[model samples]
Target: MASYFSRRTIDFLLYEVFDATALTRYPHFEAHDRETFAMSLDSVTHIADTLMYPYYREVDRHAPELRQGRVSVHPKVRDMLRALGEAGLIGANFSFEHGGQQLPELVNACLGYILTAANNSMLYTGLTSGAANLINAFGTPDLQSTYVAKLLAGQWQGTMALTEPQAGSSLSDITSTAEPQPDGTYRIMGQKVFISAGDHDAVDNVVHLLLARIAGAPKGTRGISLFVVPKYRLEPSGELTDNDVTSTGIYHKLGQRGTPAMHLVLGERGDCHGWLVGEPHRGLSYMFQMMNEARIAVGITGAGIASAAYYASLAYAKERPQSRRLNEKNQLDAPQTPIINHPDVRRMLLFQKAVVEGSLSLLLESARLADLAHVAEGEAKENYRLLLELLTPVAKTFPTEQGVRSVSEGLQVLGGYGYTEDFPLEQMYRDIRITPIYEGTTGIQAQDLLGRKVPMGGGKALQLLLAEMTQTAQQARTHEALVPYADKLEAEIERLRTVTGALLPYAQRGDTERFLMDATLYMELFGLVVVAWQWLKQGEVAQQVLSTRPPEGDELAFYESKVHTMKYFFHYEVPKTLALATRLTDPEVLTIASEKQVLM
Candidate 1:
């Protein structure tokens, strides 16, 4: 059997299911058509499969070598990245004049899924470059022209620096400072820890978008400002010049060793030139522009990893022979069947399939919201923005947490072979473990959901999201087969409402940490219900289409499969929301109050 992403599934989602073709009706996407979109995706998939996927095992084996304060990735990996950059994939969504295809976020995300799925580390060089380009949009023209081309061309790479040893999650505690220089630029002096791709030698230069406090600025997050700090400065004519930024060392990782994580010292030589992006004291606002975008990317990364692990395990299970049923009625003896034939193995594979694919749907839906919000006009546009904001936390958290589960189950399916480096499952497991820890921990995302996101616009965001879910439920009610599922979801919505009412006041009363201690569980609860609703909506649409005009051949099978998967998620997975709701209000959870005494 061929191991490739299902192109038929992509077409169904792109053309039939989401009616993504309707995007052409919008002004922002007016210049693009389905053919161009399809071509771009196909090119990216080929590049990812051919160039990126092959390196996965080797990179892990020969992890970047750190020598004398400099880290060196495999030369071949660098060459492959250069080729990918030359293919215009590094800046897939940038405007045309910058040597990009000006693709919509939807198309760009679809393209990203392929590369990320093929090899996540290989995509980091481009991912950070694209992020820096977004910051460039708000930067000066000189800054834009100087940095954008190098980044987009993959001649240079980009990184976002915000973390410090003491200020891992507390931005207000960040002590890095930027002092205004007489020459209009600021001199940034700070040590950033755990900076991803902070100092990869693959590119000509590395541009860092750093967050630092200005001298004499107010205390806390409000005093912070964002800076475009390149590792090497640009000359008067737009060429490289030496800057004070240098990496001190690289952090040895548990997995994804192909991508270097470095600890960097900025302005060690007494002058590191940096251009301030946006307004001073407004860094968080601007950084969120990148952070929110990266959140969605993280979700995609999680989904991609899970997808890879799931398929790999599926192939392994179908071929690797194992012990037969306990009560077999074989007369002489039946040859041991493939593990996939066993009920337990099947259960594991199904769990991975559901979580991985469910996570994919959630991540892609968030990307679609990004597209709709950017292109649509009037009320639809605002509604999309509201929906996007409401789900961004879920987009980041659910997939990552579930991704870990999927990978673990994948490894378990391989049993003992999974524990050795000889197999890829262990590496996948290690690589994905960090997803929930970094890029805003799962706890942080949950707090954001309960504290900031849900209550934004006086709770209008949550209201809009609930309304959309309600509309889907009402629509699904028309189908007799879906009514029960819809009714269960409706009941979950009511539970979510009751829990939200209890938690909100506790958060407001300055027991925010206690409120958020349970926030992560609540986040999963909300996500399960919300994702079930999405699946239900998709199922309803598939049902209606199948009833009125049955799909032919594989198309019919695909639609039917979607319907069954949706049912699986609803009936088996969504009911867990009830347990979560109970856990949210459980008094026993507060036993953590004594955890400090235990530590003492």
Candidate 2:
């Protein structure tokens, strides 16, 4: 049997469905083809199997600890980081000029899916890659020369240090200050909590892409600036000096204990040196660039964890025979049946399958758009950008919010053993609970989708997304088996429009609270429709394969399974939009805050 995830499914989504090879037509990816993509995937898969999966439990059992003012993680953390960097996967999507393979984001996203599924606690490279990319994109040549190479090579760890004790998600309220000096560097003074991989001793230095406010800067988010604050500063004399960044404490988290989430204190000695990355007071905008990428990565994390949980449960259900089927209750004397034969168990399995695969499909779609956004020009680029922005919040929220439920259901399939530490489900349940809260919480994502992205460019993003969904629905109409699902998706789109039309007037009238009260529900409805589009797109590909190639054995089952899951999403998940639509359009308001209280 294979591991928790399925490579065949990845191949189906990449080659058959998304046509990732076609991306090679662009000059940025011209040197690569399917062979190169497969090489990258195989390389990461091997590394994950050898260096990551084996330590999934070992790392969790021995979580990172802060002793003697030093944060020490599992020894394998160093090995894994070195392996990923040596493999050129840390900066996989970067250009060859910057020491990367110039692989498409699509391929990089698949690599993330594979690695996270194997052992999510080894979530080190993505942070490093993101931080390195920021430097590559906006840092000065001197800064890039000093930091990018070591960071990407895994000799140094990279972190996004944005959260503070005072400001968690509200960047506008951040009080971290960076004061200018005659030498052009700023003195950084602040404390950041929940900083992942912030102060690990596995690497020689930890580079923080931190956010702070310059002296005499305006209030709110407009005053924030981005800085490169390293744990160990490199002097012109080539001597490494402490930059006054200290590890105050380490958080004992519910899961993902392999990576240290540290409480860091900067400028305790008032000697923390910080170099500006791009510009002052544009930190929020600059961070948004990485934040969007991180959001998609978070979505993949949720989906990957759920995929592992689903396979674990599926394997257990097949092997652990405990109950008789409803139709075979009297045949208990004959033999015990596999729980998979039970209707309720089967429903749970389908739910997991639908969520895990559908979420992956949607994430891949977003990744493909990201790739296009990178290579495209003119309106093509704008369209890709808008669509990516529109789908990002939904992509981040849906898998996480629903992934938590899906993992819980996967645990239910194993009954008592799932709850025990003897099995992986308990850890998986704890691990996935953080996804919804990562990058941004579900409520924040909903607000982003509705409040910002939905109205951006005068609603062009939403319109373009609907057009794409319609195009997919049109293609799906060719298969008789898919027509009903396609029609259902189209209807959902219209209902979404009706609900949006109802809500926008409130936003127009400056009644933001009233308008966005049910934004999370809107996000739910929108995510369902978007994933329905992904499933239909997949079904279209599967139908073509079944009609044209007619694969046999596992191949045949794979395509058929895609169609089955597409139907499952439509039948089981798509109808939830009804209540969401009603709530979005209902005249009565229950959540909006008012001067007069009614709850008492």
Candidate 3:
């Protein structure tokens, strides 16, 4: 069987780069040591090996089907969800009070990376975990009592039901209405489209942390409220009954088809009941908790798929012999050389490694911050939270946008076979396309980064991030082999600062559209620089080991490979910043539509 991911790399990032065991020093994570972390990782890996990896293709070949307003997915998904729930993996990152392992976010994220690498098609439990976390955070005792456990146990699925037919990403424009009723429940009425895992038969219930506007409330986002809208509502007598939530239709998606994406209608019979979460008009604030978590998870999914694609192509390149090498063209007696011997293939393979590992490092950095934000006290907590807010969109966008390209490169390494279904790259390419659009589209994430996050708190978040990146560079400067890459990273920080300084004036001048016109490109540039910082950070760790008592054989190759890939990312990938920064700073105003299209 082909290996879908690198467990060794996962260990290096978790234990070496991020220092997962150090998180146990926090009181909240005091119970976890490396042994516990290892046990959890090993258990999840076994579950992934048995349940998810083996059926990656079988689930995709047979997708969920909607019949008579009910959706049924592949039978294996039922087993996978049960195994995840039984193993207590669904709520791995939750607190002990919530019946979770109370594992550090750093460790929890690695588990997700492993599972997603095995089979991204079975992305069901993550939604449930996010939804349960919402109720745990904001819901009343009764709401939590009713929903949290079952959802976490994977008996009932959970989803973020934010998108509506009218308001796709515009949360303020959502038309779903919730009318205050006498029994402390709201009567929900409207349609929600593109709800992932919205309706599926693998679980007994699907609980939606839905966003809707209450009657006579303020307009736009301030009027929004969150509710626990379940498909089967529990009655006073403890019997489950239909809650007037209809599965209007199921979307046959381009990928991630194992879980049903549904078009749902509530209160079709004027009987849909929803219990309010938190206070009125503050729904958007509460939902951001889950939304941000899902954003990072989507980033993991992107990296995971890219990792799988990289290995698939890497294995193929090692075994598949083609024409003789360019230098060995005259050596007919040399026979055919492994495609890996070719320089171009090597370049592509190096690129896939750079993106996959670099992206994982970036995500783990965010996960570490998340753990800190959750456990640290006073100023430390607020600072970690703010830094997380700044990196969320970038974290969500970079792996996903670049992962699509990285998977495409992996496909290229396999030549014609990559396009055919005989290989997994084609499916990986299709699967990763949806990630950039998962939490938010690339353009939206860019606007979030350059427009809001960059300037928020008078630019404190960006300042903190730069300080962090600079610290990594300074540490790497001590290692002679990593000095050059460290220097380039330091220079890139200044370029980022200069670029930000140049762009803020448009926003200060009140030209919002003009300020965000090239936001997507800005996102691309920002992702590349941040990922370069991540590469250097990894190189710093690998360099310290190699310079000090590095082992022989595969162990030596592993550390050396880390340094080599860091150089590849800097030399081959970092130069593009010149073009990006140039275009970003240029005064040309081209993309904004102003009733002056010459072609039209």
Candidate 4:
């Protein structure tokens, strides 16, 4: 199958939109250059295509099997993960002091898209390893020395244990207890569910970053504490010891089946030991450190899924010969043309193209912000942080939502064959479903964006975002094709600010439910406006390229296609978001009293 990620798009986004090469000016990333990053990404892309993707269908057909309290992965998949670790691609974002290459996070994000597209299930083991490495970064020195190297090297795996039976998205409602023991370790007693890669055969042990309550620490969210609970005890010589933690059962899930959905029992025998990551009763704060990273990770997963489906459909469309074009069908036996010749098929492909590529642009931009947040100095760092926070929810939600839609459309492109396992679309649909639900659900992310993230840092982040959009609008004034689109974008931004300001008093009163409900609409509006900005940026890049005659015929068509797609985005997506902004302005509630039982 043809790769959906356009090298041209990558070039345009990195150099033209983001000036990615200039990141080398920062002392933190001076060790690398654009050529090195490109080479690394090329290597990852090869591994993804040759090894990871080859087993995607096989692993799906043969998921993890649990017996005797142990989850077993296919040996081939396990070996592949080990090979990825051996190649040192697992810790692409960590610092060199931690045995990583110290590549920029943007570069890693680009490389991650390849891995995810290849086989998302197998990628979890590596993803968790990176997450653990991050946790160790912000954690104590003891924690880093003990687990950081192993996680980065992929000798051990890690999982985030947040959800409990009673504590769905409401972490404040959690009741898990962590009692401090005399040996400086806490005895953790809790049941964590829906924990991905929680227990698997590939790694020798699993380290769970669990959230639980310390005794008499208050109630609700304030009392929570983050614990580093390893599946086994570590010896002084840096080897595994029996810790008595066990996987009671694993869930038979709908997608991403190659990885296990674990139900874990921590210290069931009153022996599970946990070391605190930070201060007591400060667990939620620390866990959020991981959550923010996971948010971007989730967005990348969604984009990767969409890219895979788009590539599959695009390949199918170019190769599958169907009925002749309407104008040429009069000759009783006119030769059949590729499905791309059909206007409706072209529409579907174009829609998929705009959505997947647009989502890719947004995701990579978020990653660029991540890198900027780290290496960028002074105002540049602060500005990038604002951009990162402002787009986090959109980055996470839009791709998942659009990915699901694109996979469905891809299935439609395949007709009857799409419904069966004979084609990859059905599995793609199944796999993409979990992205929105995992890391955080769309509703949860929406609430985070509007109710929390928007107001965070006194809305400096949001203002910074508005300033960038305004600057873009200023730049677009001279371009006839882009001016109207930029104007519409500015208008929507104003509308959002006005509606959000109007709701501030209610928001301040802790009437958070209504605020969050309206915030959902705000999130959708934000995604539409933000992606439109990306599309407009792409239009600017393509416009310049098209101004000069391209040396190659295909190169000119590719650039023109990008310009045409960006126009499609402005006309189709931006207008609809204006309605959502208007809806957010209304001070209506969706409480039980507002609707009849029949409607409910």
Q: Write the per-residue lDDT of candidate 4 for residues 207-252, one digit (tens) a residue.
A: 8888999989888899999888889879779777767677888888
Per-residue lDDT for 1-600 in model 3, tens only? 468888899899998999888988889999989999998989988988898888888888999898898899988888889999998999998888987989988999889999999999999999999999999999999989899899888899999999988789999899999999998899999999999999999999999999999999899999999999999999989889999999989888888777788999999999999999999999999998898899999999999999999999999999999999998899988889999999999999999999999999999999999999998899999999989998889889988988998999999999899999998888889888999999888888999999999999999999999999999999998988777888899999999999999999999999999899899888888889999999998899888998889789999999999999999999999999989999999998888876774545
Given candidate 3, what's the lDDT at residue 455? 94
In candidate 3, the residue pairs with backbone N, CA or C atoms under 3 Å apart (3 or more residues apart, or in different chains) clash, namely none
lDDT of 2: 0.91
State which candidate, 2 or 4, has the greater TM-score.
Answer: 2
Q: For model 2, where is the 10-residue window of minimal lDDT?
A: 591-600
Task: Report backbone clashes per prediction.
Answer: 0, 0, 0, 0
Residue lDDT tens for model 2, 1-600:
247799999998899888999999999999999999999999999988899888887889999989988988999899888988898989999999998999988888899999999999978888898999999999999999999889889899988999999889988999989999999999999999999999887899999999999999999999999999999999999878999999989999999888899999999999999999898899989988889889999999999999999999999989988757777778858788899988889899999999999999999899999999989999999999999999999989988889999999999999999999999999999888899999889999999999999999999999999999999999888888788988998999899999999999999999999888988899999998888888899889999899888999988998899899888889999989999898888898777767775677
List the global CA lDDT of all models.
0.80, 0.91, 0.91, 0.80
Task: Give lDDT: candidate 4, residue 329.
Answer: 85
Name the lDDT value of residue 277 in candidate 3. 94
User: How high is the lDDT of residue 201 in model 2?
Assistant: 72
Task: State the displacement of the C-alpha of residue 532, model 3, in Å, after optimal TM-score superposition.
Answer: 0.9
Scanning candidate 4 in windows of ten residues, the lowest lDDT window is 591-600
